[model samples]
Target: MSVPFALFTHCGIYEARVQDTFFVADQPLDDGNGNPPAGWGNPYQSGTITVTGQRAVFHDDLGHTVTFHERPGATSFLKLCA
Candidate 1:
């Protein structure tokens, strides 16, 4: 077998597709106050995320959820979700 491949493109976008729907994770960041930064404002969320097999998981200071699907690739998806 081989390790899965994932690519993160510019403009705060991550492309991880298999056969069905793709996963898109984006979170915005503030400048402490209402002020904005140059192309820095509204930055995507930088949290710990993992997509093993068909289960895409997102974890942060808050709770997280497991999205189940027939995502092709590895067995971790099942074991993780199961």
Candidate 2:
């Protein structure tokens, strides 16, 4: 499959089903410890991601699959997986 474009929550992509794979492009700070400072565009990484069901699987450049949970929330913020 062709590589998907990078996607970040910054451009107001808060809540929705990612019907396909895409890249995160960067990684944000650990929100569990404290809130990320303003303008921290979801610093995950830039790579392939297979988003299906209620989760998003991130495939790094090295082909490592990192899974993340998808929660219901406003279109402005994302509730990290616990």
Tell me each candidate's TM-score: 0.29, 0.40
Name the candidate that leads on TM-score: 2
Kindly report which residue stretches of model 2 are placed more than 4 angstroms away from their true locations once superposed. Answer: 1-44, 78-82
Worst 10 residues of 2 by lDDT: 21-30
Runs of candidate 1 with Cα error greater than 4 angstroms are: 1-21, 24-41, 64-82
Candidate 1 C-alpha lDDT tens digits along 9-52: 22323233343546533432224453222343133323354557
Candidate 2 lDDT over 1-82, as tens digits, reads 4245354433333222354322232343334445333443453335665665556665556454445566444243344432
Clashes of 1: 2
Worst 10 residues of 1 by lDDT: 73-82
Q: Please report the TM-score between candidate 1 and the true structure.
A: 0.29
Q: Give per-residue lDDT, candidate 1, residue 54.
A: 52
lDDT of each: 0.36, 0.43
